[model samples]
Target: MTSEPTHAEASQTGTLRGSIGVAGIVFLVIAAAAPLTAIGGALPVMIATGNGAGAPMAYIVAGVVLLVFSVGYAAMSRHMVDTGAFYSYVHKGLGRSMGLGAAALALLTYTAIQAAVYGLAASTLRDLVVEYGGPDIDWWAWALGLIAIVAVLGYRSIDLGAKVLAVLLVLEVGIILALSVAVFARGGAAGIDVVSFTPASFFSGSPGIALMFAIASFIGFEATAIYGEEARNPKRTVPIATYVAVIVIGVVYAVSSWAVVLAYGSADVAAAATADTAGLTFGAAALFMGDTASDIMLIMLVTSLFASLLAFHNAISRYVFALARQGVGPRSLARTHTRHGSPHRGSLFQTLSAVIVVGAFAIAGSDPVLELFTWMSGLATVSILVLMILTGVAIVAFFARSDVDKRWWHTRIAPVLGCIGLIVITGLVVDNFALLVGGSSVLATLLLVLVVLVFIAGVLISKLSAGKEVDRSEHEESRT
Candidate 1:
């Protein structure tokens, strides 16, 4: 077991506290709501149409790259346990400056994904509400309802969050798995098409475009660190959870995506996505749901989207709370509830931030996915890659500087390999940014640009805040 940060105050202490056990930890790591969010299914559909048999291979490739990155990430987490998100990991390993930039990026990346999903949820639900109730209500209103539910859950203990995630995880993974088996049971694609899981498929696309989608699929996994402050045992729990989450999710994606390729026939999968890539394709849903039942799947997806938004909102807030507690963001954001012991202030801020963003987009009439995932996802991926690379390097630097002796392979070899892989993958994703957000409405681009600008602005604000702290300290001494 590794030591958590002195600042965390050990929420469940001494009595075998972390209590989350392996079960809770696994659920948190899987983040079940994400796979069900339409992004996973859509990516597979796009791959089949755009690249032929190569799409599932892309997922395999992405999973491998991420698995390599997790080696160093989990290693670092074992030593440093702060809910500060990536910023904290980099800060302790790197410095205050790197931490600030990382924090800024995390905020933008997560918030954008959450809000974008809201737009998706709203649009899909609006259609559902009209069809089911024959009444047209504002989608934003429904989105507001989701925000409230997330706020309520966030107010509860972290363990409750884990429970909720566990239940959702089963649903998301179960449904996807069911579809995969159903497709395979019928010998749907005519053959197994085992070749779809190779590197050849990954490089077939412009590879750059496929990489961007691949990176987006992995974003939710990073939230594992946010649970650091709450984990039953940060050292053992964090490292294992980080690796397990990536590996498990990656495999599920590879298997499920390959299953889709087999079912649809590589030729058909690509075509479906190319036609309307971001929109949910209901061939399987329609198959299971019937013409009238198609509405049921749509409704379930909308629910999943809403849940994803809330989950992210919870993550972003915890990140802000982490920074605040360290005196980086507004000091008030750091406050935790005296009783629930939750990051009450941070949760409130996250919900409010999301509400403001959703309202802004609704007013501007923006395209949610294009705006949410494209630009925002791009920036987030960039930031996370930067953090992952820095964290990997930080592990090396800390061990070298501290003279903390450990196995060279655990400390050196793995991280070095991981860093190189991440650096390359991140560059590829960012370079092909346009491919990801292609033809998204102008408003979509502008809003994402604005989101990036906000992150940049955060860096400046962090610096100013640090300066004020120094000045205030000096003034107190002068008075003495």
Candidate 2:
């Protein structure tokens, strides 16, 4: 038998360099969640159109479900360390065809979400510029410019991107937490309503939609495992990072959202949100803190979106690299930069794809926030939930046949419970798909159909690609 490749050899070729610690990985994962963007953007929408005052409860419920999912997910990370993450886990348990399908869905999930964020980020930036007396410009121009900057950052060493994200994450999260504290300290609008957590309120006004949006906010937390290969001592680092990131995201979102409800009082919050969905969070900041605090939050919102774009860019590029390395994509995409040790080819590919998608939306004169962000983000939310369910099942299957670390909680119980919860959430998403995508049933149906077709196409590609299984086996062995 031939000798295994050295660390240096692997780094110079197929394997990503290990440079990040647990904190770095956590930064990347949490930054992708974009606390400010989720609170200031998605939270108001959830309050207005979802479960209203009970919106905070929805976030708590979503967090608990994902925490259970992460138990088994972290266990799996101890055994396998690869950038493929969900694709590799599903492949190990469900077989190559299902693995490829999961991979394709993941690609769609990340790509579409990134594009969605770009739409919002571009629009937000355009508005900010005009508010500050800058020259008027199209949203697409701002989007393209942001994409170019992300491309440069993504094309560099992974640590550089992590550092940038760490700073942005700290600032946005700090402002949000500060705002939440101020609201509570001032006794809020109605003395901190605990009724928001009541079952009656929680189940009111379409809880399914509320849950869907809450869960969507947690999308980027699973990305912890995606950075495993680049993490120092991944077996330890990945698991710790995963748990920490999940808890932090869940807490930040839940507390901040609850604070927003307190700022407006539980009774009138929904109406206020409906009246001014875009400005609801800003208004809360202005009321609880000061006008200066609100202005700072507006600036932080842009940075939060920028940080999210960079995080997702890194994630999508790595997925492309992983697939290419597995012989499921172009081999060139597998190549890393010799100097930067980053997935340069994959980064360039993702950049171009974003440009093309955004260009098409612009040329068609689609509304960035309404059409591009809503539809694409809605599609991503559903697709990712489905992937999570599949991954939970795959974890159970993989552990059933293997003797490695046979803890029942980590290997079976948690995964099964998480799977069941995910199934329910997925069903909810499907039931409210039209509402999630701006009340367009036709568009919702088409998007759902597209998800199914993309998965089927992936399965077909796996069968058609010669030597794919062999390539996957060798790749896994090398990493192990």
Candidate 3:
């Protein structure tokens, strides 16, 4: 008779295979953040609705917080290795139960963010087509088409994702850089101004809101560890990529937002942003490099959204694979492609979820940007902030008893401080949740409850499943 496969043997079926270097991982993380999307889509909102001229300063401060978080995070990555990432680290530091809970939270967060981008991409693509005198296609039609494309790519080799992201990221960042350089070269409506970097400007408007947007832009920086299994020399590559991504994203965001302030006088930026909330960046591009540049920026904006969608799709698929491998989800989900070594099953599941979400919103006749993008993305930001705080605490817990590396600062001091900072940020997110989701306190509360319940459900299912297996083994022993 054939022997049944052990759990450990069975779990090896869908292992990821890649030798992605730091540059490759960085490309994926930065592409997920989508520099152009942040600049053209989120920056003007930050300027008009958040901290006005002080928005750039908020990016600097947010960057500092993440860099500090990286200190403990990088250290943890060295010792604890798993693609489950946040969940795996939490398991090593905390307990398996808490780790499973974290896995559920991570899945929720990534799924929501991916769906949010689909909504944004669909709407943006629809407008882009209509602007050029194409037929008025429904946003859902575009969203469905893009989902099919992403599904195909995400089910392939990890290197394919990296290569595609690298190309899209370069073009998007290049266009934004060109626009920023033009803004600085032409001087301001007034003269060149450094007011955006000043303390007074930093405190001038709703800095809390600005900080929220700035932190949101750093969404994928923590995902370096999610690809740990695929990364070549993961310990070194993960840390380097994490640090580089944070600093690069921070500098680019601050510089670009500052240049926007300079293009319009610092004193007048809020008014300008308000007047043309949707077209402010394009208007600046038109003024500096002519209508042709503005057109190019608009087209790149669509591609930028597509790049982000693909990046997040891959992230969510990996999370699913990690969970299924550990028996937290369907066993079939853990199986990888024989030739490509891709988590094809998980990719399909994630695509199906996206379809359901996008379809539901479309059927309800909700405004894609307002209802789908803002609400879902805002919920994801809040969920991720909670995970960050938990992971920081887990790092401290992990090191308090062990003496493996023996670096007090990395294990203790930095982790403690990072946890505190993230805690404060979480509180801010909670307090401003209504504002983040466009003043729907009820919806914000519902999302928070949903996240909590999902976590609890995961923990209970794991515990119950373990208990059942133990009981069955005991019964067999009694029979023998």
Q: Tens digits of per-residue lDDT for model 2 on 22-51?
A: 999999988899989999999999999998
Q: lDDT tens digits, residues 1-480, model 1? A: 988655545432211112465566667656633676534445644464346567666667778877877776777787777776577767777677666776777777787677767766777777777877767877777778777888898776777777787777777777778767776777765666676766676566666656556666777777677777677777788788878888887888777777766665665666765654544335544553345544545556765665566567667877878877777757777767655667777889988888898888768776655554345555555666666776778777766666554767767888788888888887775565545565445644564566557656767877888899999999999999
13: Cα error in model 3, Å: 0.8
Q: Sort every candidate by TM-score, greatest first.
A: 3, 2, 1
Ranking by lDDT: 2, 3, 1
When 1 and 2 are scored with TM-score, the better candidate is 2
Q: List the residue pairs that clash in candidate 3.
A: none
lDDT for 379 in candidate 2 is 94
User: What TM-score goes with each of the models?
Assistant: 0.87, 0.95, 0.96
Any runs in candidate 3 off by more than 4 Å, and if so which?
1-14
The model with the greater TM-score, 2 or 3, is: 3
Candidate maximizing lDDT: 2
Clashing pairs in 2: none
